[model samples]
Target: MKKSTLALAVALGAIAQHAGAAGFIEDSKASVSSRTLYFNNDQRDALSANQRSARGVDQRETATGLKFNYQSGFTQGVVGFGIDAQALVGFHLDGGRGHHPNSNSFVPSDTDGSAVSSWSSASANVKARFSKTEAHLGGALAPNLPILIASDGRLLPQTFEGGTITSKEIDNVTFNAGQLEHATGRASSNSTGLAVNGGSKESNQFRFGGADWKVTKDLTLQYYYANLEDYYKQHFLGLVHVYPISEGQSFKTDLRYFDSSSDGKNGQAGYGFNNNGGYAKNANEVDNKTWSAMFTYALGGSAFMVGHQRVNDDGGFVWMNQGSVVNGNGGSEGAGGSSFYLFTDSMINSFVRAGENTTFGQYSYDFAALGVPGLKTSIAYLHGDNIKASNGSGDQSEWERDMRIDYTVQQGVLKGFGTTLRHGAYRGSGTGIHDQDQTRLIFNYTYSFL
Candidate 1:
């Protein structure tokens, strides 16, 4: 181990030791395991505004990660004492030097077409679980809601510092809360920096609450609220229902709504920051609202889907980027190259904004009936309209088409082998939107050590 790692272990052990280590220290049991992950991405036909072929290597990135998980059972039942832990280490592999340009993931195919030097960081979490729910306090990596969520679309993953609590005492009703502190950027191997969706750099502290209720066996409802330090406050409401028909046909519906406005800090200046260091002057504080609905019908081995969303005013949608601080949470949830808005992933905070409307459509097929058990494919397209920008202009529009494929070994020599691929194309004109194509590939494996 490196000197730094040894020192970290000693520090952690001393802290736990001094805390009386009594009621909370003695857990039921302890066990640890290891994990590994590999990732890659390649962009096609990329160029700068001058139409100058991006002046760099085409595109590609790769990384490897090793993770350690620790779990301690409750100390003595009733309200048992327990703790959960995770430690991660990642190394860059194929991301070339000079490839850090527009490096959404430390990989954009450097100017020299060679990979960058590898880097790593380590983090751990402390948790207490009882009944069906658990609460965690400590710092490792956080996948937060409200203003931001860590973008893990790369080799290893992102982490955050904070505390979170969850409960499922009542069926269909789940409650969650957390106070975040800081975030670790993806390309960076250490916890540092704060930024908002292609916006400016600033501190973000996030607080949120929500519930998911199963009104009936086929219908569900959800509501959520999130406040970001100095940035904005967001609200969300949603409904989902599924109906079955015939032997294997069903219709699924998902509807969502959101509203957002400036919070304490950003409201003061209206200036925003993005990953790279740059600032906008007199950035007008924005207000926005959105509603989106997606419906899917399944018949035989084919499934079709349609979804729509609308933004009401001049706000080009915003969310906490891994580099931002408001909610100070990070993780692999936002990984890869494309719009992160998909499902109503507001497991805590809402990701959509006002002044913009969006529509989503998808089609999928299962090959199991054709003798392929672990193979599945899906294609999706999303469009947005009625966007508002600081220039007091609307009509800023953008759309994306994406395709995904997944496969895993069911049984055989490589029983646990799994693979995934995502292909995407996006374009927009006016209001600071860029055009690009992206491809992401991931390979993961797990081993049992009981």
Candidate 2:
């Protein structure tokens, strides 16, 4: 593609030379969201028993996201400049793949594979800020912290066209950095110049750094670093706390940490770049690090929890899950199924780490003291054990259980509407895929203009 757009125009001229235009954007805002999806799967060991005879079913999906923003405020002093725009659309109101639907990517495919419905993308960005910090170049659409994580799980939620930065000056501390070249996948519609799974060695590169600390007010701390250039190198740590043992009750603690290994040409020389092919070698590279702890307690409507995690080595502790949504909505930030890695992230499965030390616990509830104001609920369970490479190998184990319900609209007339329902089930014997059941439904809508 013309040398990947001349290497993304020389990497956006070095992120537009440190961007400086002044509080970029003075006004303008628009938003739209719509999604309805259902998908199912059952791999059956992926063929060769006469190519098996099963795959998956259930399908119905849709997507839409449109955003517009423009901010301008700094041109008079320090350094300010701004501009932002976004547009995305998709459609596939029904099922395809004859129903097995290629096993639920919802629907949208066509590189000679079939199943095509609709798609679209339009993006723009330009920014700069001083003091507290802000730097955004162009090609907008990043969902969160690390490198690339913007996944709404079909029907919309995946974007990239790089350059990002943030700072909170001291006080409580919060700093983030970014550098991305290209991406816009999720049954794509256009803007596909960089590839990872299809590999052609097209990448403008990405680098990241992060921090967030709040030593008081219940304590909080998090750290991060990421680089995905040739693909991989990550680190993250987190801590959350809140304790109070009476009236309204309080007791919560969440701790997480991760240190992944390998990068640049998949860690070059010593081999190690099998990503898929049923993996057996490449060692998947090692040097993993994981730690997890969960404790929650509440009384009004009940809340209780427990947690555990470990993965010292033998490969396991990967980050940037394949379904990364944009910067990482993956959560667990500690890099576990909620980690830049997880079980744990339902939707299909991500109990994270295929080899060793993975445990979990949960129970949550919030009915707004019985009045059901914006209701909230949770139920979870997970387990993983010394699961090293198996199938033509040994050492394996797995387990998962989940249930969730969410609601938001605390005021009249559907205020800020948001709703979610999730279900899960998983079982493993020797790990190479097994019985699993999952379902998800989420509704989101936002409006803001001033």
Candidate 3:
């Protein structure tokens, strides 16, 4: 057994004795969340015979997901213990052969290149608390940090197998640390080692640490560091501030920066980086610096946001991506989807090519101000240019536009029911990327039981 699995077993055995303790039973909480999603992607660009054979024309599918969660509070003692468990199941509602891609970015695919009927997974985390710090060890970790963002764009959310510690011992400050060994993809039931896009070999170790400091009520600073053994190392710094202009108006500024470099074995045969199909000063090596700044102004129910991001000329930005990681069966492990923390991580494409400069803006409105309690809408656009290509190819440019609408029931039995509709269109020139339009419709509801 893995060390983490063994540790979890021992911890669970120790905590079993106190499962019925006062605080444990009294503070327990349970909930079930349901999500149904309809996804459609239309490729608009023309393709050659080889391209048509390898890449499908488009993708359209629908799936329903149910997640059940149970969180038990810490037992009463100097050192308290608890457990968080979750079960997830996904069912394919619709999608035929020609409309569904064999790649499992959205839905699990069978051997015959068809969607699976259903899939399920379950996990539990053993936790302990001391002072103001808490630690968890399990296979169901979903981390939202500067170095990693658990992906949830599809029917189910990606999960990790690892241990994490969080502490708030210092006032106005938070600390986080973790080590992940494996990950379960959003559409996969099995867990696999970590790797970036184009990397076939997997790395078993991914360590990260970070701190967030609230300097003031409206000001915050963050720093984080991460390392994927034999892959890459990265550091991130961020700052956020909000300035109040009036009773119902404020201005917010957010800044982010990242520095990444190759680690042990990086650029090796199976550990090479593709640079997202962009230029790299040193072929197959990780070397990049990126920075972005965003400003937002809010007045009443209206808000506007704008941002600019730049990627250094050395290489394209990099993040954890298992898109090309092959499984034991010599097939994709259904782990192609991933998420990164960047304004350029749009619905269809991420504009992080080397030497790229991107400008983005968004406008949003809430209908509550107009007496519609649970309605909201937003639209955004992003344009990127001066993207350097490999082999001394000419630079490229791209643009994307996205729109979203969300509504929720505010009363009666469906008070928490939510509906979200989103659409995005992307066009690129000289980038070798296909132009596409995408749409997603989602319904969500959650029920709580204490």
Candidate 4:
């Protein structure tokens, strides 16, 4: 199906024929969530063993996911109406066929390459409101805007299929606009058209607009613009502040910037760009400029962070990648993972190439200030340097380190049951990129039926 799920099933059959429409069943909501991952990757420079058996390179997997959501409130007012729905399922309890890897990146592969025992999908969204404005339409769009970031790392969450609007009429300002065309891949149940990382031509128009101005109560400001009709055009700016330093301590600041160019038929030939493999001034076009800054300090449950980023010797740093879009039954509409609203987006590296320069730091802790309630921990590190190198052969360097821990189950029958453990390590030298190590273990739960 997917014509945005047949126009959200004819707008949920006209909102289920207005089933007693008074505030839509008194403001409904429902939820279900579950996740379980256990993924591992090693590939530390897998040089041989036939290049680690043709690149499946030391992997491991496990999956479990379930998600359900429903929301329907609005429906009693002047112009209110609503519906939101989502459903997902993934289950592939283990890997092995030399650890999966027919490239749906994390799962969904079976044509003689294994993995893919279960998969499911569903989506809907139709909404409206007026007064402070709201609008949404079809296919579970998940946008955490600043020019787009919707990739929940794996096992589901990378959705989009069109239409959005938000307003918040004045008072502290917030506005957004959108028009996404297609994407659905956090492990494929197929939906694709949008491209960038090594574009194989797709781009069914993506447009955006943005705002966020909360000029006080600890300042904020942001701006955005985006376009992808034939391959790139982005702009963004941001700033945030919080400096209270007294009662529990605080000091935070963030800044970001981006500017990109090259749109129509970018660098031609199927709209090329492989800049992520570094250096690209005019070769596969799309110029870029990036910037970042971050600082944080909190004291109550301890937190500290630091950052710096820059990548602009000419290219690299672009988002929305359908990972070489291939579909029409030729397999893989796996939409190749993406996320960008960068703080160097890392876990196994994404110091966005072309003349890179990154530096990062982090430390976190919260054990309920040592009374240990729900626990937490963190560690991070990144170090990128100069990078460029693409035959002009010169600079390159990379580094990564990450760690995490979390726990939850705060009160009764497994209160909120959560657990996580993560790890990462990466290293590189000339940037053909291959040293790696990664791990994840997660479990989560949620249930609410209201």
Candidate 5:
């Protein structure tokens, strides 16, 4: 059994011995959710011999996942305490040896390059609440912040192992601080230390602190600082504002900026940090600046959004990645790849090359406006240019177009069932990656039992 599960078992035993905690038993909640996913990726461009041998030009996979969650209310006391537990199991539906490339995108591969039949994992956390502040410690954390985001793009969601404290004592202001030691990828059950993309060295310490201030009813400000020890340090600043144009219509503005620099041992020869696959002005040094702004206009069930982003000429935007490490541990098989808090982080690509400038726009509509409730569709396009190359020439560009539709049953036996379809096409010139097309189909449902 995993350490987290064992710890939770002991805590539950202790709670059961003292069965008089009214809140713990009276206000508990439990739920189970299931997701079925179909994924396909088609490589349109030709690849070199080595690339062709390493991965399939066209790949497809299908899988199903079940997730169970339980949340116990805090015990009635001056300082309330509680526990949360989650279990996830995945089963392979289709995807034979030909489809399983050992890429760890949707499922873990065996030694013979075939997808595993099934996998399961469990996690738990203990939490304490005092006034308006709460502290949590455990291995099942999905943090959504400007610097880090847990990916749910695949069959399962990524999770982190760590401790975090959130305080909302001040009116209209919230404070957050956390220390993360390891992460469990969406496809694997084991956990590993943190590292930047392309870096092999893992750092056990990831420290972060942040604050959000609601200056007014329509405006908010955010600032955060994060560091992956021996990898990189980052600072983030964000602003969001919503302006009311009239009834049922509004204009929203979101602006974000990030500044990153090299930490210890990044520029050294054997420490394995080399700007995470982009050209850096200083050899192996982590130096980057990224900024983006998005504006949206909403009226009833229709919304339109446009945004632009710029990556400084020094290096590509850097974030935690654990894909390249192979430590002989179970985590090495399916633990890698992460998501960043950016609109351009799409299904198959991220428009974050060094010296790149990107423009993007999207249009979405809810069918409820037309009397078709629980239906929605959206389309988006992004174009990027001025990517820096390794040979001192900074000429590269890429573009992607994406479309999605989703529907949820509003009534009857399958009232909570949901279906989603997504497709994307990407093309690039002078970029290191290839042009490709990707599609995903998903069905999901949830049941609650208390």
Candidate 6:
């Protein structure tokens, strides 16, 4: 075993030896979960003569993921201390050299361009708590905030190495702050520094602060500021409100806005900042504004939603990227990809190009209302236009349709077993976008121990 791994084991053993102490074993919890996923993607309509000559993507693969977690209660003291340990393993069940592509969306590929057999990783966090505030220091964190969200679209979820503090000492308000140093991609075990999309230079510092306030029983407001040193700085404002119409019926509204600009080296030459594949009025400087609004109505077991989003003409929506990082001990395949907080973030594409306007809608139903429990389905569609092309072409447009169905066993030995089916189709005209079809089938289950 590696020296690092051995040392980690020794530390964990020491903790286990003290499990009998107060608050150590009495409040401990452990759980294991597994997921099996089948992914397929078919790209249609070649963009050029070379693309026509080359093989279009028509690949399918299957993989399995296992996750184990252990959480220990805080020690007995005015300032309590605890630890959390998590481990992940992924196994590639199918996909050979011919089926594997450079995309590396599902499984990491070997040097010969074949899917890897297996990969695994482990992480731990040391935590402390006082009053209603808590601090954590560790790697393998999955943050779900508007400014930064970890991607979990693949076999494993993306993780970040960082320190974060969250406090709720005040009523109706919550505060959060964090400093992230590195990120591990969903398909690889190695971690790398951060950068914006299409940027090659890695920035090790990403600082953020945010707050969520509940102004009323039915309304909430949020504001956040984030900076990726030498990349970009961003600020976000959000609002959410709900109005009850009747029993089992309500209306909801959500509004979001973002303002961003270049930080340091982004505006300098020799630095990797080009507005991430979009038209930036100020050359490589990050200059963009984006806003979106969504409304939903619910009656009984049915819900309907519609939303619109606008991306400014200066540049495409910007966010962190790790795709260009140099792979260390982990495989190079599937090293970087990301998720943005947008309604247009769909299965096949994110309609975030420069000068884009997107309209989206969705409808969903719960089968429980129809006498069937643990079953639900939804369908959504999005259309985007006025995309600015870098080649001086006219505006481009694209559309996508997605459908999903999920079912879970509610009782018996397989009570926690769950399955989901998702499909999406996309078509575009005038620019880099392509026509594609994608599908995913997922099976999941979990067991808990105390």
**Per-prediction TM-score:** 0.77, 0.31, 0.96, 0.34, 0.94, 0.92
Candidates sorted by lDDT, best first: 3, 5, 4, 6, 2, 1
Best by TM-score: 3
RMSD per candidate (Å) reads 6.6, 23.2, 2.0, 23.4, 2.7, 3.4
Poorest 10 consecutive residues of model 1 by lDDT? 273-282
Model 5 clashing residue pairs (backbone):
none
Q: Report the lDDT tens digits of candidate 1 across residue range 321-429.
A: 5442221222222222212344533111122433456667788998886898889999877766555544445566667778889898999887777788877777665
Residue 213 shift from truth in candidate 6, angstroms: 0.4
Worst 10 residues of 4 by lDDT: 325-334
1 versus 2: better TM-score goes to:
1
Candidate lDDT scores, in order, read 0.57, 0.57, 0.89, 0.83, 0.84, 0.82
Query: Model 3: per-residue lDDT, tens digit, 193-232?
Result: 8887557678888999999999999999999999999889
Badly placed stretches (over 4 Å) of model 6 are 1-19, 47-56, 274-276, 326-332, 392-394
Q: Show pairs that collide, candidate 4.
A: none
Q: Taking the tens digit of each residue's C-alpha lDDT, what string does model 6 give over 342-403?
A: 87888888888789899999999999988889999999999988888775343788899999
Q: Which TM-score value belongs to model 5? A: 0.94
By TM-score, highest first, what's the ranking? 3, 5, 6, 1, 4, 2
Off by over 4 Å in 2: 1-42, 46-76, 86-103, 106-114, 121-128, 135-140, 143-148, 151-165, 168-349, 352-427, 430-450
Model 1 lDDT vs. the true structure? 0.57
Off by over 4 Å in 3: 46-56, 326-331
